[model samples]
Target chain A: MFLLTPVLVALVSILMVWIFKNSDGGTERRKGEARAQAEACPWVDEDLKDCTDVHQVEEDANGWQESEEDVEHIPFSHTRYPEREMVRRSQEYYELLSKRRSVRFISNEQVPMEVIDNVIKAAGTAPSGAHTEPWTFVVVKDPDTKHQIREIIEEEEEINYLKRMGPRWVTDLRKFRTNWIKEYLDTAPVLILVFKQVHGFAANGKKKIHYYNEISVSIACGILLAALQNAGLVTVTTTPLNCGSRLRVLLGRPANEKLLMLLPVGYPSEDATVPDLTRKPLDQIMLFYFLKTS
Target chain B: MFLLTPVLVALVSILMVWIFKNSDGGTERRKGEARAQAEACPWVDEDLKDCTDVHQVEEDANGWQESEEDVEHIPFSHTRYPEREMVRRSQEYYELLSKRRSVRFISNEQVPMEVIDNVIKAAGTAPSGAHTEPWTFVVVKDPDTKHQIREIIEEEEEINYLKRMGPRWVTDLRKFRTNWIKEYLDTAPVLILVFKQVHGFAANGKKKIHYYNEISVSIACGILLAALQNAGLVTVTTTPLNCGSRLRVLLGRPANEKLLMLLPVGYPSEDATVPDLTRKPLDQIMLFYFLKTS
Candidate 1:
């Protein structure tokens, strides 16, 4: 009986290992098969046809000469963890996002640089156009630069809000109690200007074209918002309030790059106040085959 | 020393409790204040204005009836986990999406009904326009309906692909090796007819206004894609290769809604294949700023 026990135990252990290894192998095989099928797909590239006549993206993809040494390789497995805390994580995420307050007024006490950096690092993780990541964040810390930006923004906003450029749409914006006057520009310690570069060069100077540029940038913005909320910081996502051309002239951005958003990031002032706005209901924002996703 | 022990213990414990209570209050206060600030911020409204006409919204808001719930009662948490396994998750997501191959040729082998319903249920949670959600997903499973849809879709697609629309865009689409012949419409067990409601209701037979209809619908699509991926199903996001209005007429959609995307949702054929396109890298898709907001 004692001899039989060891033999039985060995069989069970071997079986367990085999099952685990088999499952892992099965997943990989499935993925590879899926990828193979995807590669054979001819429909997704349906738009690629007339490229022979006008422009093909092949050159843009091939010429990049970014050196591995200079390029930051974000280690893929830096934050591996077990699955037990997903529910807790989801709860915290909801709680933090629920705390997301769009603030305008700023007393501008120094924010912990570490926190700001961490949030940006998170934002950097946002998905982007053509994977071009096609954005440049320029933080204007100087008060003078902030004023310069504010002036430029207000000037363009004034034109948009008052002139023909803004349709009934812009006029309606007036009801929301907003003006071109941005006080946070001067008050906030940092102004992060997000730029979307429409196209860039690989080392061979072949241009890299981005697909769904706006959508990609917008996703990145969403991720950034989530990260900032997680960091216990307050932020106001402010658009240029102006156009890219004017802002480009003001900020001296290259032609390939356009200003996407101007963010004023800081702590809320001690006595800052906000308007009593409300979000649309869940029934309003969510739609399905008439069900909820989460 | 024995006598002193009780007194000291009592004092320290009381102090500890007091500190804990104060910190709790502080947290509550901060949370309340932060949400209030978010609600009242001009920027929040300002951002909304970009998506919805504030004047029309104000008119609605002014006459708005309060919901049974209080402002603080609402929640907007997606998940608590940031998903520490970036590579694993990214790979998972890619695999999930990669599975969304266009199934032009489907076999009516009677797929499980829950697989289809569960996917649609997940899509319903997408955050969108004025929270209007503004989308309708109609699942077509019957063979007759599928055939009719395929016939109708192909009729318009032939015209579109042959030449009747924007040249640059349509021409580009052809390279991907796609034509409007939708065999899967008849073959798959389900066809998702997605509509983007351009306008909203008038609670009292009035045209209720919606802001940023297109943007709202677009976000909903993103959510739908995410939900579908999460559910272990696959779909092709098929923008009409034909005039939306023409397709609408063919599909018998309401006059107010537009044919946005026709999703063919189901499992891939055992031998289905796709183009071997590479997804853009993380750095290429993400950008960072000096300040971050989650």
Candidate 2:
């Protein structure tokens, strides 16, 4: 086990104090933001003094909770690992991810439905803009349905490879040699079709626009991939352009939902292969700037 | 340790055979995708036929490896946790995310530079659309730059709040009561200005269009936030609309890059507060369909 230097221990203590302090004062009054808002913008003609009153707080009437102001918040405590443990955990996660590949050839091996459910549940925990989890996972397991999707997707891909893509674009794909032929679509035991909700129908039947739907859905997809990889599954991230409307119609989905990705989830085939690509090294991808000391 | 049931062991053995088969046949030829591509379409004349010959594969002159086909692939082994261990890890991660709040009040407390580096490195490990990795993490610590950013963001936010937003938007924000003032921008010790490269510059200065830039960058940002939270740091996802052009200019970034997200990283203030919020339960976000056992 690695030991922390005295200076490093001091820095960690400071961080620990900050973390403890954050979870400590949950019951205390949180008037700082309201007070700052009122003081910072006095240009509003309405008297801003009443804004800081805790009694004026409005609670959600139709929300899941009785009232937003009265919502229960319990204390959160996290396990703090020693320096050696932290290093070990970080290295383990990094190594796990390093081995993950964008698999192209997949087998029709049957995966237990519970494994998929757990990963999707893990995906739901991703944070979204304004807490609007504007994403949905449609787990497709019916073989007939998967075959239909593959047929439709291949038709579009034929056009993409023949007329849609430019010469330069095709040249760039020389490494992977991917020419729109999606055999894995039908071969994989399950296809997770992800949809991004552009708008939701409120209780009043009015359309509510979702903020950052693209960004939020992408984040959820990332977590989903991580969960699947941790569970020892392999998949390829496939995007078939110009098939959104067709997919929505075919799947009998609502008009407000747009298909973002079609992921074929299963084990890699015995002779499966991926383009032996490499990510840019860490130094090229990261820039670290420390506070300058005089 | 929880023992695996005999039934589960059988299932796991099936899965293990599939996994081992994939990494075992290193010398096998991968003609499935290339053959499928050829048979699916007849448009690829003699020119495209040569593209499939393994001997004709182009070696990466500048890359760290030789030809993509000749590149060695090592065995990808994952840690198989006991059922109890799996449940515990999954629950722990979910609980950790549940407690994460979008903090508003930030302290100027100094954070170790190493912590920030590790998280950003974690972010860069996110999988991209086609291994493009078209994202840049610009760590901003200069006070002058932060001040300039604050001034420009506040100006745009003022217009967005008062002039651009509709009445419904303002009503939705009633709980937080957020106005044009963005004190956290300058108050936070570091601002991670994430820029997504819409296109890359080739060695010869030619433009290379990036696929799924928006989706890829968002995934990276999600991993970054998870890493930060795991490290016991707090941050808020802040987006100052219409300030992207000005920000690009101010930061002296290249034209191919666009501002994706502006994250303020620091310790939460002593009196820090967050809006009372709730996430929809798992059933609302996920639909699980098991394969018909018939």
Candidate 3:
């Protein structure tokens, strides 16, 4: 009986430990499930995942100071126009940009490469965080390569539609009449793939962090869109779901670069149609705090 | 002695449980420390923190489809230019944009509010993900409010430089000659604070997830920058570190909105100087994959 009592004490201790460990394990299991859920959603691309916190402080802290430490400051020349001309220019620019639409049906006719180059140059002028300018513009004009890209994007997008994306997302896109089949990918004469360099190498080959890289790249994209519109070309902005890695590998971009956006640039097809969409009026989108002029 | 054996066994068992719990507690403590470290860094603003994974699928999943379901499709009209005009326009646009610099020195002269209105309107035309158009432009023209903003930003920035930002980051920004004192915030005629709507309410008051809201808003800011340059105004793009929530509250913006970028808009001061930074050449930034015509 005495021996059994000792055995009972030992067993009870083991039971207590198991109970505590099991509770902790439950929390760990829940975290694992959450991560799994995130991975299952293909629209939540790995590329979109924010790793800035991980390397923000560790890598080359500031590219602007590091790169331009030796460069001299120059007087910024002014380009001030008369108030009348300023108003006229701003009004005309607004009118021009307001006419831009995300045209999907791009004609197969070849566009001037010089125009494309100029538009990209305009995009490069966007101000980046710490002036990193962490972007790569890959222009693909090969029909075979374009077809391959389309195939990869379509395959992943099909999975995104059929399984990965929930019913809600599918329902949300119903108005656009968009599907996994991307006809413009095959028909558009040029595909400009924009990549954001997550990090660049310093002169010593150490990693240099690109701060706010995704935002910077997207800003450049906005300028690109405006330039295209100004030149009377048309394109659609697309971030192909779960296709960044595949496209990156296919295009032979370095590990530091991740696909941010894809633009199929060309002229609009004759039968192209757009959903009659109107933007919110200025009052709705803007708020002003002006000193009460007595 | 017989009674003592059972007590001894019980004590030993308790010791085992304590050891196991202590090891688990160590891991939990480490995690807490890591989180605390992240909080200590002021530049790692909560506003810049990515929360898309949390509500991405939960809120209005497909805003494009939901909002535009009833809207009718219309034939798209496009303005096409001849090849020569397209090239000329693209080249001129590039030259105009390339001249744009992040001008920090601003004159106290008031800019025409109408031009500001037109530029914001042009920014509103940028494309958004799922047609969410999730952005708000807060134009602060009241001098008192602008001074208040400068005070808040300077206070936070002082903390960022002295305490939160490590020596490495301070060194990184040394070349820019930027400090906590922001005279432009008070001197510039307009302080355009761009905010991103993380989530919006649908017509039914249900939460609508703004997919890619940050990127969308940044794109708008890019177009806004272009418009400012086209109108011959100069401004510097500033994302005040750790100043989002306070500035948002100061501007009386809603909880759903978070400040993304702040621009001090007006004419450049006479002595305005810029860091003579050159962008990456076109060939360096771009790669082409062209099919060989047999």
Question: What are the candidates' individual DockQ scores?
Answer: 0.02, 0.10, 0.56
Which candidate number maximizes DockQ? 3
TM-score of chain A of 2: 0.73
Q: Rank the candidates by TM-score, best first.
A: 3, 2, 1
Span of ten consecutive residues with least summed lDDT in model 1 chain A? A42-51
Model 2, C-alpha of A290: deviation from truth (Å): 8.3
Counting clashing residue pairs in each candidate, in order, gives 51, 0, 1
Regions more than 4 Å wrong, model 1: A1-148, A162-177, A183-241, A251-294, B1-143, B164-177, B183-194, B204-211, B250-252, B267-272, B282-294
After aligning candidate 3 to the native by TM-score, how far in Å is the CA of A29 from where it should be? 5.1
List the candidates ranked by DockQ, beginning with the highest. Answer: 3, 2, 1
- Give me the candidate number with maximum TM-score: 3
lDDT of 2 by residue, A1-294 (tens): 244456645655665565455433332323443343323221111211101111111222232121123333333333445455545555555556567777878889887666777777767777765566888888887887788788888887777667555444455566776877888988999899888886555666544545556677887887777666666778877767656667667777776688887789988887776665677877777665444459
Interface root mean square deviation of every model, in Å?
32.0, 27.6, 3.3
* Candidate 3 docking classification: medium
- In candidate 3 the C-alpha lDDT for residue A104 amounts to 88
TM-score of each: 0.51, 0.70, 0.90
